[model samples]
Target: MRAHGDFSRTADRTPGMTVLTVDLVHHPAHSVLTLHGELDFASSDRVPPLIDAVVKAGRRRLVVDTVGLTFCDSRGLRALIHAERALAALGGGMELVNVHGRLLRLLDITGLTGVLAITTGPGAGQAVRK
Candidate 1:
């Protein structure tokens, strides 16, 4: 299978916060985005456009790994929700993986734990063979 990722070095400054750095893997079945840094008002706006571009290209399922993600505000959550809805409308879905600590709680409090197609890991949602 063919897959691609967007990796970057160095930080881009925008006013007070550094922009969220996203590493994306575009695959035939799905797109995997490994997000680093913070997703707040300053950088949360960076996500949807990218997700839209992916969706527009016909990739449906989206798996977002929040392992490297540090901080996320309301704006970030909004961006995620928008992407989820965008994908849902296309008959696709979104998943969250490697979530822990406050981020997990945040998703629960915001009710995204139910909204997002969450998994324990990349393969957790898949049925295991004995």
Candidate 2:
């Protein structure tokens, strides 16, 4: 199965360019937010609202499926970090799944690997459809 979504820049001013697609999957044990497309400065604006919505929905555990992610920049990483922190503060947790290639390398190089949970394949967390 395949899913698609799009986010664009508004009148708000920002440098750089990015687009984010988020797919929410509901599972028995947890919720999965699958991200696709490029996540950078321009697109980063969408991260905060989405994160807020997830947290407000009272989801205690979340798995972010990054398998479809094509690009991630410092801004994207920062957004992830914010989400991680938010989840922790809410007495929940978040994990990143299916991260590989340059993105994995970037996480390692930036010392973010220690901060976020990275899963390479299935079984990292519960799977659900939404």
Point to the candidate with the largest TM-score: 2
Error of 1 at 37 (Å): 1.0
Write model 2 residue lDDT over 54-106, tens digit each, in one string. Answer: 76666767788887788889998998899889888888888898888878999
lDDT of 1 by residue, 34-89 (tens): 78778777677778777876776678888888877787889889988998888898
Candidate-wise lDDT, in order? 0.73, 0.75
Candidate 1 off by > 4 Å: 1-19, 121-130
lDDT, model 2, position 93: 83
Assess candidate 2 and give its TM-score to the true structure.
Answer: 0.80
Model 2, global lDDT: 0.75
